[model samples]
Target: MTTICVDAMGGDERPEVVLEGIAAALAADPELEVLVAGDEGVVGPFAESHERARALVTTEVIGMGEHPAEAVRAKRDSSIVRGCAAVRAGEADGFFSAGSTGAIFTAATLGVGRIRGIRRPALATALPGLDGHRTIALDLGANADARPEMLVQFAHMGRAYAKVVLGVEDARVGLLSNGTEDAKGSELAVSYHEALAAAGCGFAGNAEGTDLLLGSFDVIVCDGFTGNVALKSMEGTAKYLVKQIKAAAGESKRSAVGALLFKPALKRVAAELSGDEYGGAVLLGLKAPVFIGHGATSATAVAKGTAACAAAVRGGLVDGIAQALADAS
Candidate 1:
């Protein structure tokens, strides 16, 4: 059985949303077990009622704005730290949190530790692709600055993740650049492009920002600074478009009627573009599977995110990445 340690006190909402999501996740997977880490007074009762759920009482909680490394060290008994410690202790196969991204990354790196030979860990998310397949993008916000060698490692790691978690065979990888030509982008992009091509890991050359949703490549690698900017921009644009569509739909009686007629299609489109549908971002290059969800994540998103983490563990994601890196070396 695969067990995942969950941070019951993490996220904007407290133990309530976390417990409800855990119940939903447990109901969905019969063989799964959960270890809830938070204050015993809150999470203990809820965990007791569930069959396969257990609670590990933690006294402290990590604030979202705290310095990641400092908080991890100072608050050793914090929910985030304890949850990661569970994985390191072999009590859980993975860890899931909708808490501070920086804190979680720090805890995971220090507690469960990084895979041998990995310079840094990356946060990868599945983006909706035009080809009916999800494209994997990495270094979402793990490191604001990265070297060309790190980007090359990101490509290999992203390829392994796509194959294992997304079930894509021979995933194509591309360097995210200003243009498709090798001459475009900064010096880092140029160096990465040449290195990846020589590495021969299904290099698809360079891809522009427009290619992200076009499914032109199965995996795209870039420095965290560029990747994070692109991610937030797309998210903001999606929200703006949705709002505009809703407003237009209610502009007039005739439009309302038209919207009613196409409500089903519109709902489908909304789900397709929703962040919850894809769960949360996966933290790659760790010793175990770890997923970080949005801070304001809903109960449904939590359930889906936990399920995604479980799937990653079952799919041998860590082993796959280790093997890929070994082969590349």
Candidate 2:
């Protein structure tokens, strides 16, 4: 059975949405098991009633605003910490949290630990693309500051994740830069461009921001700061476009009537554009899969992230990264 440790008190919508997501995940995957960590008062009855669930009662909760490292050190029994501990202790195969990104990243790195020969683990997500394409991007928010060599590692890691999870046979890696030309981009990007190319980890050269969804590159690598900014910008732009479309659709009775025919397609596109397509970002270069969802994630996202984690575990994500890193070295 593939087991995942869940942080029940992690998200904005506490135990309720978390429980609902767990229920949905359990219903969907018969062989999946969960080690839910949260307050006894909240998670006790759910664990007792569910056949595949067990609760790890926690007295402390690391609030979203609290300092991640401090909370992790002080609140040893926090749900996030306990969940990572569960993974570290071999009680669970993966960790899933819709909590503070800092907290989950800190706890997972300090607790469950990084894979061998990895300097810094990165956050990656397969951005859904047009024409049935998918491009994987890395260092979403794990490390804001990274050296050129780290970009090399991110390239290899992104390539491996795309190959294993996205089923890309020969993942092409791209360095996110201002222009496709090697001479373009900041000093770091130029240096990373050179280092990534020399690393020989399928570096396909520089890619512009517009190329993210174009599927020209299978993997996009960058520092966490840049990647995170790019992701949020894309999300904001999508929301704006959706809002405008809705406004346009309602401007007149004739248009609204026409919109009725395409509402279903619009909804699907909105869902895809909302950045909820993947539900969570996969933290690569770790010993186990640690899925970090948005703090305000919905029940759908919770379920999707949990299911994705289970799939990653079954797909040998850890083994794939290890093999990729070994080969790169």
Candidate 3:
């Protein structure tokens, strides 16, 4: 049986929402087992109620505002740390946490460790394109300022994500830039473009910001600072456009009728744009699969994230990365 260790007290919503989500996940997958990690007072009852769950009883919690490295080192018994330790100790096949991104990264990297040759582990997620194709983007917030060589490594890892997770063989890779031309970017992008082409890791030309949703490339590579900015901008724009459309439609009876006619389609669009669709981002280059969800996650999102972690375990995501890096070397 595949088991996933969950941080039941990690997110802003805490134990209640986490427990509800876990119930949904357990009901959906009979073969799946959960090892709940949190304070005994918070996680005890839930574990008692569910036959498939076992509580780890962590005493500490890493706050959203705490420094990642410091919190991880200081709070050895934090839910985040213990969860990662569970994965490393073979108690769980994978892990899921809707916790502080920084804490999750620090704990997972230090506790579970990275693949032997990987210089840096990146956060990779599949964002849906306008054409309904999903493109894998890396360093979503892992390393704010990465070196050129790190971007090259991100390219390799991102390709593995697309191939195994998204089922895209021979996925094309691109450097995120201001223009499609190889010469039209900052020093980092320029260096990445030249190095990626030489590395022969499915190098496509440079990708403009629009290419992220336009499906112009199968994988878009960037430093965490730039990628986080671009991702937030896209998210804000989508929210703004939807709000405007709904407001305009509600202003008149005729428009309301039109909105009623397209309500289902609108919901489909919203779900597609929501980052919760695929659960959360995967911390690539680690020894095992560890998914990091949004701070404000819903029960549905938690369930989806749990399923995703299980999928990664069954899909051999870590083994796939090791083999890919070996082949590249």
Candidate 4:
């Protein structure tokens, strides 16, 4: 059985949602083995009560809200650290958490470490654009700032991730900017675009925020600061649009009838727009696969994230990344 480690105590909702996710994951993958690291007393009972959770899980509870590094050093018992340790020790094939992004990144960097020659790890998230095209964006807050060289590295990393994970061959990489012209972006974007172009990457010119939904490129590379802002903006806009649609539907009987008539189709469309439907973002460039789920993730979302991690392991993503970096170096 492929083993997966989960930070059972992490998340805005804490043990309840995390536990719910774990239980749902176990239910979906009967052969999957889970190592839950959190407060044992709390998580054990929850896991035991669920047949799939109990049958498939092993437990080790750690403290909640402890400083990440200190907890990693001192609280050999903190959930995030323990989960990373499990993956590092080969007890788990991958790690999943809806925990503090800072803690997860810190613990993983220290415990599991980066792939050879990778300067730093990056967070990669796939956002659905127009035309059923999914655009993958990288450095989504892993490294708030990046060098031109780092952006070049991100291109290679994003390319490989899109290829293996998203099954997109000949993935196109774009430099995010305010305009399509080479002169339109910041100094870094212009320099990086030139560097990427020269580096033999499939660099598809500049893509503005407006082009984000146009699917102009398969991968978009930017420093985390820009990427994070873009991500939040998109998420907020999506939420607002959904709220507006619901409100509009509730305004009159005619709208209510229309909502019922199109409810199934609307549900399908909503699922596609939801961030969780893409599973979760991958913490690429690490030695082992790590998926960071949304803090408000439901059981289905967590289960899907776990399955994505399993696919990463089976597809040799970590090893592929190491080789790609080594070749580029």
lDDT of 2 at 74: 96
Superior by lDDT: candidate 2 or candidate 4: 2
Better of 2 and 4 by TM-score: 2
lDDT by residue (213-251, candidate 2, tens digit) is 875799999999999999999989888988898899999
Candidate 1's error at 142, in angstroms? Answer: 0.4
Residue pairs with colliding backbones in model 1 are none
For model 1, the superposed segments whose C-alpha errors exceed 4 Å read 260-264
Return model 2's CA RMSD, one decimal: 1.4
- Least accurate 10 contiguous residues by lDDT in model 1: 268-277
Any runs in candidate 2 off by more than 4 Å, and if so which? Answer: none
User: Which pairs of residues collide in model 3?
Assistant: none
RMSD in angstroms between candidate 1 and the native structure over all alpha carbons: 1.5
269-306, model 1: which lDDT tens digit per residue? 76666656777898999999999888887788788888
Indicate the worst ten consecutive residues by lDDT in candidate 2: 270-279
TM-score of 2: 0.96
lDDT tens digits by residue: candidate 4, 176-229: 888888778878788877788788677888888866667569889888898889
